[model samples]
Target: MKNQTSITSVLLMSLSDDQETISVLFIFFLLIYLMTVFSNFLIILLVVTCAHLHTPMYFFLGNLAFLDMSCSSVTAPSMLSHLITQHWSMSLSECIIQMFFVIYFAGSEAFLLSSMSYDRYVAICRPLHYSQLMSWGTCAEMASLVWSTPFLLTITYTICLRRLTFCGPNLIQNFFCDLPHLFQISCTDPTINVFILIIVGGTVGIAAFVITFYPYVRIFRAVLRIGTSDGKSKAFSTCTSHLTVVTIFYVSATFIYLVPDTSNLLTLNCVFSVIYTLITPLLNPLIYSLRSKDLKAALSKALHIHRLHPDTATRR
Candidate 1:
């Protein structure tokens, strides 16, 4: 029989038991964490400095970049420290705090993603109404909704989930304290938690994403109906970056949550998480800059001026 007491008595699972693997994992994850942070920070800087990127699209792009940076930062750094010291110990409060940040940032990302989809939909579907609809005030409100509502949901679930008991061997198989990971490590029946996860993930993750895309789908249809080569190219050109982001985000997220929860499939889930954690943040900014004409122009001028500063300095 296990201890079934209050939330203070609950203990989390250790990350791993292998000493050699832990050290190796620490070095690898540290490098990844550094790159993820640096690249996203650079994107934020470029977005802020480049005048042409001051539009709604870039503004939201900056938001997504910041969220990605935050997401990786919250999860990666702690995991690295634990791995290096082979210390799988996380205090109860620390575990809850980690989970809070994880959920907050993850929920925030989910909301921001939906908002980005809405932004794309308006820009592509109703170009005439975009300025009116996606005005600065409107944009700020959209971002707020995207960040706040999900956080409330996550906090509610956390409060409920944290009340469960755990008084046995605690060793989490995964690299981090994920939602499903918590359920697996718990002593009590995680039926309610899993049910809530499915409900929230399906309702918020899938439904919200679908709702956001409804307008974009219409925009995509409208663009395809146009007969002109130039018109089709232009319409697609406007949406290609967003589409790429949508596919990467949706595909990876669905794979992680929708997969059957079993030991055999855990490896696949971890791999998918790595992509969401490591790659997409760095890739999104590159995709936007590569695909968007305004970004390309601004980035080019910014880089050119940057390159010239050294020569100008030498002359001075």
Candidate 2:
């Protein structure tokens, strides 16, 4: 109550209130979190240890894995804790921190997927120059831009958020700290926040979508131009996994955030949030690893090498 005097904390509602349901949800989410962590970590480990995966494509994949892990971490642990204890209290500062990273990682991922698409475009469409275009230095720069742009955007938004006050009821409808829920509870005018969300969020999402899919337009043309069926098949195979990932991610994210957020849609929001936050992270590594024979072979080779020389894997 003392802290409430200054609006220091907000209480979050649980996904479920029934004891049995809570128990089930806790187990389900715990498993999801663990799997996301393990899968992403495995991808990172594979990319780092496998000598064959040192290309720009794999470099972007590694960054994607890291972003997936980070994006999930921003909200999943708190959701897990709330599922067990049903005590979802987060201080103002903590909420802001979570919101910033959630936005940063999620936004970065949107752009990172676009960057990966560029890498693929260069590989498939500009095969001869792929090496020069997607060099390590260029890949590093792309990765830095993908990450740093979102970092700046989120920091700017967070700074704007800090200027607003939260003097009303402090119950966040969702399990995590998201902009919509926070906007619903803000005492100060949220016009600035709404503007930022529209301007920054819309620009990022639209640009990412265009950048990610435009390459595909040319990629499809290039694939069709392949003289041999085998060549076409191979090129399509390389893209299908990425296309699948982009479809799921953009669909779920667009549905969750861009759609109308009415008071009665809390349940819908939570369900959609789970899709993008928890399920998508789990799916990314599986899609990439399962689809890429190169990754599988490298993983097997790395494990074999690790067995023969464990120090080699660790040193990477």
User: Which candidate has the top score in lDDT?
Assistant: 2
> How well is each residue in 1-316 modelled by candidate 1, as lDDT tens digits?
3545433323333445777777777777787777778867877887898777888888888888898888888778776776666665676566667777777787787677678778878877787999999999999998888788888888878888765666434555555666666666577888887778778756777767776567677887989888898998988888788878878977887787677857898677778877876667667777876887777787678778868797885686
Give the per-residue Cα lDDT of candidate 2 at 249. 92
CA displacement after TM-score superposition, residue 84 of candidate 1 (Å)? 2.5
| Weakest 10 consecutive residues of candidate 1 by summed lDDT | 6-15
Candidates in order have lDDT scores of 0.75, 0.87
Model 2 Cα shift for residue 114 (angstroms): 0.7
As for candidate 2, its clashing pairs are none
| Candidate 2 displacement at residue 194 in angstroms | 1.2
Candidate 2 TM-score, true structure as reference: 0.93
* Tens-digit lDDT track of model 2 for 107-145: 999999999899889999999998799888898899889
